[model samples]
Target: MTLIYAMPGNELFAELLMQHTGYGRAGLSVHSFPDGETRVTVDTPLKGEQAVLVCSLDRPDPKLWPLAVAASTLRELGARRVILVAAYLAYMRQDARFHPGEAISAKLLGEWLDNHFDALVTVDPHLHRYHSLNQIYSRDARLVHAAGALAAWIASHVERPLLVGPDDESRQWVEAIANLLCAPSVIARKERHGDREVTIHLPELGRWLDHTPVLLDDIIASGQTMLQTLRSVCAYTTPKPVCAAVHGVFAEGALDALRGEGVGDIATTNSIATETAHIDISMQVAEALTAVCNIITERRWG
Candidate 1:
């Protein structure tokens, strides 16, 4: 049988996945040493079972050793396969070395993870430069998109919504959601001044001025683009803007800053497990995991 094991902090989402996929449950424990090393113990016996580890790779520095050792321990315990279901896969943005002597993290981390895990499943990795994850991963890496879940939420929560993308990169998500809901969408242009500073340019609201504007993005890192966009959006007479993203990596007060700018509603998938993670993507994730095991299942927050 396929057993679902949730790394620390992933229990709730993993339970949802287990319920949806009819998968069995497993356990894991970790202990940190004073010297900064980690000890992991697999609590469930799985002599010949496939294991799925739900560990979202956000703020992944401290979690890496626990994850690697857990996977290794599972293998040592005779797990047939150990699949990593990292809903918010990190280190994807740095696809290449922007400067000299820089470590290409995407490749470097991919190799590390590839060696540790049998397969990879994640949702909405920030793949702006490369075509697919296969370039970096040697394992059977699967990607799932959360646009359907976002569109469904918009269709239910808002009326006459106007989907707004932060920049050219968000066109894929904006277009998908717009098409799904049959709503008008517009893409804005963004200029980055620094990590926490950005300038956003939006087209004239024009005839679609009356529609409720929904600010959509794949990731909300420092919230600069979304903040500047929210400021620009507020300048108009449009309804209070709503924010939706697959990964809610609201780095240090980004959510409050948006609220300060008069945001109407903020919803993100449980990829990063924040207060605003109202949208559910567990069923989608279960579907993806089941598919690999020949089980039928459906942003899955890959």
Candidate 2:
């Protein structure tokens, strides 16, 4: 068993973690410094105990500071082992060299955290074609695919839903979710030149588009891709609802931007705690962690 802790930056995340852990003891405290920095303290005794720090890596700049401090302090407090549960992991998109001299930020972030934690757990991490978080982080890093949960939620709410992937990259998720719900799926072609601009193309689906549709994606950093897909689909078909695994990273004015585009309702798995986030994928996250923890325990103690 491990001691679970959460930060003020993500109190709801902490509560969810506690519920999932089924561990009666949960502890956390965070304070802001005069210099605008933050400090966190774990009041419970962590000596020689396994500790699970649950934090959603939303806006990295603000959350990173406290996360670093908390990890270091917990390590110093004699925690025998530390596991990080990041509901949303940032800086994972830069897995490849898009241009010359571009730093592989995802690699750096993974390596940095690799030195601190025993295991990493994240839900629906944005992975590129060439790399994965497990390859980036040396320790056991579990990428929890929430497609099943998302599919189940959609099935419970909507009947005969069509899953639409915003782009080719999201087709994997779209297909997985559709399979889970026993539904059909399609992926749009997306073209992007730079930030804040995108083009999505969807081939005609005719009567299939007339039914309830649920747009799905692994990440929604800027919401541009989704808006483009929504517009493209809406242009030729009837209005359909949209939902995603990770919602509303809502970068910039993405929320308003998407709403302005006539997006009916949006839901996400609490990967980044947005207003559109109506669901929590903590249970899914916990299940992934449990699997990883089991493997590690077997390998270490076998």
Candidate 3:
């Protein structure tokens, strides 16, 4: 098997994956024309070998065409199978149409990738309405959890940690981490008025006043939820709440906004490359990839 990656700030992740899986590395060179056209080149032969493409679809629009070209080119280069390891799968929020004539981008992107890759692996995709990745994707799809790593980080770093979920949607993540650490957990009631405006009703934390509150969530896109929760927690307590997430999609100065709002600390998994990626989830992802490769190998030999 060979790993091929194309993106800035992904070299470290690629190196970690290579070290963990002992997979050969393949080079991919991308050139962009003045007219905004792109040319993708795979610099290594992949004939009779499984090709794994490592890409995190954070800002996915500009990378889509090149990814498509690369995946198709891998098949033409005689790759036995092409597997996609998308650390942070995008367009998952639009799993369903909220309004009439709305396009379901999640399903569309899933179908598009399904047509290209023989298998897919991603970490903590935004699966709101969709129960599983298999519901949207046709290929062999796997979703790896980052909660264990996050929980371990919290247990080691934070003193007397009190896991707090911003809203009901975050209950699963909070409970998982809290249970792992054997700590108390609380969930805030959230009412979304708009994309930027949200009302968070936090549960009473007086019982665990000595414990440091750590707000946990799956994805932090707009930061509205975190901001609201931070303000509410601050109003009632002295210790500033630390905010952490699996995928830190800090969109449009959201990180700045969180910092400005006096959030104690902000950190996230290395799903998308950002300054706040203090916790490493590369081992988790590499383990999943190894498992997937083992399964594929067993099936091929069986």
Candidate 3, after superposition: displacement of residue 32 in Å? 1.1
Which residue pairs in model 1 clash with each other? 122-302, 123-302, 145-299, 146-299
Per-candidate Cα lDDT values, in order, are 0.87, 0.77, 0.86
Q: Which residue runs does candidate 2 get wrong by more than 4 Å?
A: 292-302
lDDT of 3 by residue, 1-302 (tens): 65556454467788788888898888887899999999999865656778888888998998788888888988898887888888999999898889999999999998899889988889999888998899899878778899898987887778988888988889889998888889999999999998899999988888988778898999999999998898888877667789999999898989999999888888899998899998898887888888887788778889
Quote the positional error of residue 256 for candidate 2 in Å: 1.8
Q: Write the per-residue lDDT of candidate 1 for residues 150-240, one digit (tens) a residue.
A: 9999999988999999899999999999999999999999898778878899998877778889999999878888899888887874688
**Candidate number with the higher lDDT (1 or 2):** 1
TM-score of 1: 0.95
Q: Give the TM-score of candidate 2.
A: 0.92
Residue-level lDDT of model 2, residues 1-302, one tens digit each, is: 56777766676776776687675446778888899867687765557667778888878877777777877888898877778988888888878788899999888888888877899998877787546677888888888777777777787777778788878889888888778777888888889967989888787678685677788888777888888887877777665666565645778888787778777678887877778777767888877777766776677679
Point to the candidate with the largest TM-score.
3
Alpha-carbon error at 258 in model 3, in Å?
1.0
In model 1, how many backbone clashes occur? Answer: 4
Better candidate by lDDT, 1 or 3:
1
